[model samples]
Target: MIKNKISRGVLLGILSISVDGIAGLAIFPVLLYYQPKELAGLWILLTSFSALLNLAQAGLGPVITRMATEIKIDSTDSDIEKYYLKVNYCYRIVVFLVFCICALLYLFYIRDVLIKSNYLSSGIIVWAIMTLGYCLKIYATKNINTVNGYGELGWDKLIQIVVTVFSNIAYVIGLYFGLSLIFLATIFFIFSLVYLYGSKVILRIFVKMPKILSRKKINFSEVLDIFKQSLKVLILNLVSVIVLNVDILIVERFWGLNVIPLYSALVKIVTLIIAVSLLIQQMIYPYISLSWNTGVYKKARDLYLKGLMISLITSIVLSALLFLTAPILIPIWIGYGNYLGAKVFGPLLLFGIVYTHFHSHVSPILATGKKTYITPAITNGILSIILGLLGAKYFGINGIALGNIIASLIPTIYVVISTLRFFKTHSKYGGLANGEYKR
Candidate 1:
């Protein structure tokens, strides 16, 4: 069973990567063809904002993965339905709240800034449409995560590939039609709805009997337990969001919109590599919860190490490829304006990617529950931001990349090592509840 799951996970993960890669490569070309250079930056900015907004729902998926794994392991079908509805209720509430928050922010503040900066031609319309779509996407995201927790990584990735391929096709159509950002945003929203339903059909058919996270019972205590763990995992996510994305935001604001297209093209491609790096951990994430629950720490640890080794080696090879071709690739792919800076941006960002990718594997192990990983993550995230801001202030785009790389290594070699070691130590002793955890 383990071998089957792992094999299926790899197969589906590769398919997901290929389709997503095609989509990622396809979008930039279409965007470049349709929009001006500055607007490309706006595209990058809005996408990054969408990613940031996703942080609002950060803890929801992992919590689902953890809870669903527990219920599945115990063969507790009764608990499953109740847990599903209860958490689904909370998820809907979260979606609404995030929707309102983004709506209000755009209404009062960001809309004007975008117009003043001339990034958004439709201003509030674009903001409103995209914000709502992002929220829906955020909401739909849990379905994929929930299925993942059931130890169905292959099925989860299949669902993910479907949504991704369809959405990017929708995006490409919008570009070909010469739609404004507003129309594209509308297309995004429509696709979100499609996948929202599409995920249901996939989960129902593909998942084994008794889907747990879609429950009717509102188990408040259990719900709160999930929430608390999610909250901590959310913090750990900060480390990731910052390291992968913060540079684009920094460049967008400080260096002005024009420079962003240059920097962001490289960032976008590299972000794909980072996403590939993350696939290893994400594929095994549910197993961390499952094996931990089953008291199969040795199995979990061994699988995790194997995944980590694969990701690390993959990232290193990809980084070398980026160095050779990114300079040449950027101008060819996006067309050159001020994008010459990519020559410097690629190598430094790849340096950060290595550590960041290594840490991605480490994080899922620590983040299966609770806030154990939060402080160090929060500390490193903050430090990265500080250095990023200071670097952007003094050194421009290159410095910001440098800031993230430097701060990324700090936690990779030092802070997180001790945590993993301790966790391993305790796992051998008995189980988590019986283990002594020092804050």
Candidate 2:
């Protein structure tokens, strides 16, 4: 029965990820062909920038997942209900905070871009709508995390599949008709609301919270405690963004917006490849978390190793395919002008491979509730930024890509060695030491 459930979860995860990957690829072409290249570059820049807004959540989703998993493993139904209510209350506060922050950010920064583009009226309205939409999606994340904690992995992916397909279809159709960027933004906002409400309905199917129970007041102390636990995760998240997604901002500052279309194409392809490769680790993470929380340390170690091996194989194969075909396929996909030549592409490919290799292992360590990965992540981000600036100043794009390769190499080695040692210590010690093993 356990194996069957895992098999089903794997199938669902693959299906959802496949659709998401295809949607992402499909949107890339539409973006390039339909919009002006500079505008296309700006759109990509904005999309990446929006990801930074996730910082406002302070990495609460994973903390919720871990906490809920523990409760599910060791507590009663009433306990589960209490925890869910607390999480739900905390998320509402986050939702409001996110909306206000996004609004202030747009008033100060994004508004200037829209004004420069001469789309001030439409753009401001679009930004406002999108901000609210984004907040709604943030609020909805609790529902998904709650579902994941209960070990309903397949159902969790099912909700995402529905949301991704709906939103992507809206985007493609709007873009195909030559709709203004504002219209597309408006549709994005609309679908976010759909996702928010739709997920609540889907979550009820697996686990329902009674209306009376949900109305009970939540303790502020619980909210404060969850926030405190998420502090390390928030740091990890902020630096991860700097390491992985801030390249375009750096490129714009040094090389100018004109080059971003070319640089972002390379980054996009690599980002997509990395996302697909990480599916194995993502699929197994919940199980690893449960295993460690239940004191099944050996099973957790074995699972981490198995997941890492599979992820490594997937990444290498995909990277090799990309390396071989990119010179030909990229030109055909986004036009010859956008292709970043082999010299620049090679280092980024190596960077992706090395980063993926370590991340695949380190994520499992995090699942064990170890903070060992945080310091390495901080080091990686700092070195990558420093090197990235120096490289962009000297060697152009190739230099920046090379900087990333160097930045990641040390952290990669440290993480892998540390991961092995972590498991070995657990094997000898028999259970997690200290407060790391929450019960």
Candidate 3:
């Protein structure tokens, strides 16, 4: 069963992400052919908006994954089942409300800024709709994946591929027809709906029978506890996003919106590599959650090490490829003549990618244990902002990239040391066999 899960999960992940990359890559050609400047501006706007939307997600997807795994392990407990459903529903309600409110506030309050910035007027509205669609899709999909990570992934990948293919085709058609950004945004929103519907259908197939709602109704105290738990995870996600994304935002403001497309293009290429790493990380999360729940600490630890090694090796190879190809690829891909020497940024950003990959793997492990506050509060939150600001002011885009490298290093190193120390102490105390973790 374990082997089956791993094989299917990895394959589906690779398949889904490959389609995602192709779809993403297709946009570059569209941008190059139609509107290069707007393309750059759109890149910055989309990336920034994506970061904000992710912040709004507040890591609930992983929380759902954890809860679902727990319920599956203790499936015999009717009370546990009831409580899980109640929490799940409550989370959905709260997240939906919060996302809507935040989206509205941004739309109304920041109208002037967005307009003056020349971002598509309807972009935020489209984004809000898409965000809701994404939340629903994620909630359903996370639970399905947690219950049976491998089995459901095939369907998930197929849905994604379909969406990607259609979306790109729509973009090309829209561009050919001289459609506005608002129209393009609408097309994207419709694509999200398709994904949401597909995910809902898949979810229905896997949900257990005799579904129970909590006998103890969700109350103020329970809401507060969930919010409190979510806040820690939210902060962690926010800081991580800011550390990873703020450079582009800063560069957009300071350097020019035009620089963003070039940088975003480079970042996207690197993200393709990271996405594969993330797939492995995502596959590992449920295993870690289940192993921890069952008191299989050694198994969890071994899994962590294996994921780390894979991430490191993969990141190294991908980074090397980017470093070698950036000079030639950037000009050919985007036709930005001024970006000739952008390859210099490749190696540094690769460091950020490796750190990011490591951080991604460790974060879920911490979150599964519900220990979310430590990394963000201690390492990422304040320090990253200060370093990023200082670096951008002094050194430009490369400086900003360097700032990320530095900021991420501290947290990544700390987590590694702490994890290793934990295993070492456990081994010394005869907590593991041959001082080695179980598979």
Candidate 4:
């Protein structure tokens, strides 16, 4: 039965990932063929800037996942209901807070910057709509946690597949019709609707929170505990954005917006690696959390090692394929005789992604509720920014990519070694959790 469930989860994960890749391939041509160079650069910057709103979620989704897994493992009907309510409440509050912050950013900084650049001819309206899109995206993340906690990867991935397909179809149709950025941004609102629907599906099939129990008052203390755990996650999130997504803004600041299209293309394409490599870890995340929380540490370790090995193999093969075909495939996909930055950009960005995911084993560690264990990741990311800047100062774009790759190596090795050692000592000492363990 367990193996059957795992196999089903893996199948669903692959389905969802194929949807993402197809969406990527579908949209790239639309973006390149339909949009001008300047507008395309602004679009990239807008998407990158949107990542900031993600930092504001306060790590609620991850904590909810952890809590949800614990609830599922403890296996009581009432327990699931209680967790669902708490997660719903937290998701609402955090998303509301993030939307407020985005409103202020638009009024004070973003609107004027875009205006000065004279980018996005549709003007502030498109920017406003895009900002709303970011908010919607963040709100939608709650569905992922809710389903994951229930150990329903099939439902989870199925929902993602629908959402990705709809959003990509929307983007392609909008761009082909020469619609404005506002219309494109409207796609996010559509995805949010899909997510809300998915949440309802999860509730009906998995959570089944009773109407009588639903009347219970919100627990502020429980919310506070989640917030405290998520504070570290928030900082780590912000640092990651600073490290990974801030480059286009920096390039725009120093060099100008003209070069942004090429850089954005490189980054987006390289991320295809992560999109595929993470499927196994993400599919098994809730199980790992449940197993570890229930003191089945050996099973958790096995799952983690297995996921990491598979991830490594997936990444290497993709990287090799990237090197082999990028030169030929990229030109055909994005058009010819444009974007001089593509040549060396592809390989370096591939290496950067490899280093970033090098410590895939860390996922299980994070699941164990050691939120502070992310300090090394956060630290490495910040240092990567510094190194990337220095490299940009000396060797330009390729240099920055190399710096990011270099910065990640030490942290990856450190996390792998520390995590293994910690696992050994933990098993030997037989430390207790929630008063559950073996001799």
Candidate 5:
């Protein structure tokens, strides 16, 4: 039954991820053919920047999900309601802070995007609209995550598929009509609203909530403790943003806005491939967290290892196919002028492979709720930036890709080694009997 549940989740996840990835891929050709290349780059940067702005979420969503999952295992209704109260209170505060930060950043730095804007008013309006939408969406994150925590993965991914398909259809139609970028951002804004409502509906279906959940007073001390537990994950998130998303900013700085379309496309392709490859791990994440927390150490270890094997295999095969086909596909899909050749593509390919391995290894450690990977993550982010800056100054785009490969490779090795060592120690002691952890 558990296996069936996970399989169904993976199927649903594949559907949602495929639609989003297809939409992501389709946008490049649509933009390049109908819009200026620089504008395409700017839009990529805009989305990246918007994602970075979500650093305000402070890594609390997963923490809350894990908390709710563990609580629901044995806790009473009132206890669950109290947990919900605390989580919602904390999210409200965080969401408000996100809004303020977004407003201030737009006032000070984000508005400067107009310097690159083909449509000045639309750029500002779209960005502001996106920011507001993002702020509104953050609070819903906990509820969406809680649905997953309850093991309603189909429902969780169903909401994702609905929102993604709805928004992408609007995006494609607007692009076909040669609509302005404002239309794209508006689609995203509307998607957020839909996502919020959908998450709430799905969550309520799984967990029966009391009517008074909204009216309960919050305890700031409990919120503070949640923040304390979240600090390491918050650090991990910061590093993740740097390693995964900051490259475009670096590329734009060194290579100029005109080259961003191709570079961002390469990154997006690698990202989509990685996302597909990690479906097994994603499906098993809640189980890993629950098993590890409940002291089923051997089960958690086996599940993690199996998921890692499948993820690595999927990533390897898909990446090889992508690498082989990219040369032929690039020119045909987006035109010869936009293709960057094998130099840029090769290094990023290796980077993607190493990064995939890193995630496969790192996810189990995170699911265990241990801060084991924080130092490695921090090292990765710092090393990647330093190497990227030097590589950009001396060797150009290939250098940046090489930098990513090396930076990602190092931390991946550390994580694997650490995880193996820990497993070896526990296995010698007969696994779960000695490995039960406090929730």
Candidate 6:
């Protein structure tokens, strides 16, 4: 039954992300209506801040999913209860600490930017509240993925759709009533609280609060090991943020901030394609982790190939559609008067989409064990910075997209070749029989 549920869960994930994309699309109207010149600055700040928050997440998402899969396979309900409790507690604490540190940093370092931009001071306060609420939401959402339960995913998606609707309603109200940015931020925080409360309700159905709270002492050594193991992924994650968002930042520095809304609009469309790739990756991760944990390397290899095929087909079709229709669709969506076609940016984005699909889908395969993590992290970081800078100089907006494509391409090639070579060498030596091979 659980095996049958994975397909449904994957579909739910796609729908969930699509809801988020719709919300993103809806926000463009507000950006275009008010303060178009400052749109890029806002995007830069939002992305940079969000990236910092994610850094604190520290790759625990996959770890939690792996742990959950292992618990489910063991089929010991009691063990599952204990494991969930310990993990959830640790996850919450980390999230809270991360929010606090980030809020403090923003208060001290980035306050002037906020003030000068005419954003209300209350916006900062609301951001802190939203961050705390999201921490809870993230933990609850991960539990659904770990247990292969799509009910929570479906529920989350429904709530997101509602939130998006409410946000748009609030945007209209703000514009009609002349509300300040602080009020908009407050509305956002209120919506976050609604989602967090919903998450708690869903979480209670599968796990009691007491059971989800850690009673066993969490050792610093164990935490450190987790941090160490996840550090490479964390670094890889940071590099990814830079590669993806740094273009807007560079553009802001060189060009005026007004160019950002145009750039942001283009990037958001590309990100929708990426969201689908990420959904496939998320679904594949638990399966890969389970297969690897059981030493079924062949099964893992087959799964990766299957994901790759799916990714290729979907990416090509979507990329082609976006490239061909961008001239018409973007203008209709954002109004032709305000939008400009970044023609070269579209093709470069196609490459980046393919590169991102492969990288996201294959990362878990490459990160299966401690020994394999370094290659991806190192290669992604080095290439991201080098190509990012070069792309900024050589191609401007398109160059940034090209740099991201190149950055993702290198590690993907390495992982694919290495995995296939390992499989081949193992098959030749009869190591395939036991699923044991020298890497």
In model 2, which runs have C-alpha deviations exceeding 4 angstroms? 431-439
Using all chains and alpha carbons, the TM-scores for the candidates as numbered come to 0.89, 0.92, 0.86, 0.90, 0.94, 0.84
Model 5, runs deviating above 4 Å: 116-120, 430-439
Better candidate by TM-score, 2 or 4: 2
**Candidate 6: TM-score?**
0.84
Please rank every candidate by TM-score, starting with the best.
5, 2, 4, 1, 3, 6
lDDT of each: 0.70, 0.78, 0.63, 0.71, 0.80, 0.62
By TM-score, who's the top model here?
5
lDDT for model 2 comes to 0.78
In order, what is each prediction's RMSD in angstroms? 4.1, 3.1, 3.6, 3.2, 2.4, 4.2
Per-residue alpha-carbon lDDT of candidate 1 for residues 1-439, written as tens digits (9 for 90 to 100): 7567867887888788889777877687678778886676576667667666777775677777777777666755666667667667778877886787797767775776688677555766777887777777777776776677777777756766887888888888878888888877787788777767766776676556463344245757876766776777677766777767777767767877777666766776677677677677777777766666666566566656677777777777787787777667767777765455654566565654655554665555653453255666776788789998998898766787777777767666655576467557656775544322211
lDDT tens digits by residue: candidate 4, 263-354: 66667766667657777887777777776777766677777788888888887787778777777877776767544445456646566455
Considering lDDT, which of the candidate structures 2 and 6 is the better prediction for this target?
A: 2
Q: Of the candidates numbered 4 and 6, which has the greater TM-score value?
A: 4
Cα deviation of 349 in candidate 4 (Å)?
Answer: 3.8
| Best candidate (score: lDDT) | 5
Estimate, for each residue in 1-439, the C-alpha lDDT of model 2 and write its tens digit: 5456667877888888788777766677788888876677667766676567787788786788888778776777678779878887888888888888888878887777666666677767777777877887888888888777767767767766887898888888888898877777777777778777867876787764554565777788978998988888788778778878767878877765567777887887787777777777766777888878778787788788888888788878988898999989988887777788888888887888887897787778778777547777889889989999898888887888888888888888988888888887896688643323444
Candidate 3 lDDT, tens digit per residue, 1-439? Answer: 7656767778887888888887786677676577656554653465355555655655565665666666666556674555455556655765575567456746664454456556655656655565554455445544454444322335567677888889889988987787766666667667767876776676667656455454565566765655566666677677767666766667667866667766676667767777776676767777776666665666766777787777777777777777777778767766757453653366455655755555755655563463554553457656667777888788766666666667676677666666666644543453433332233
Top-down lDDT ranking? 5, 2, 4, 1, 3, 6
TM-score of 4: 0.90
Backbone clash pairs for candidate 6 read none
Off by over 4 Å in 6: 39-44, 75-78, 104-109, 115-145, 148-159, 206-216, 422-439
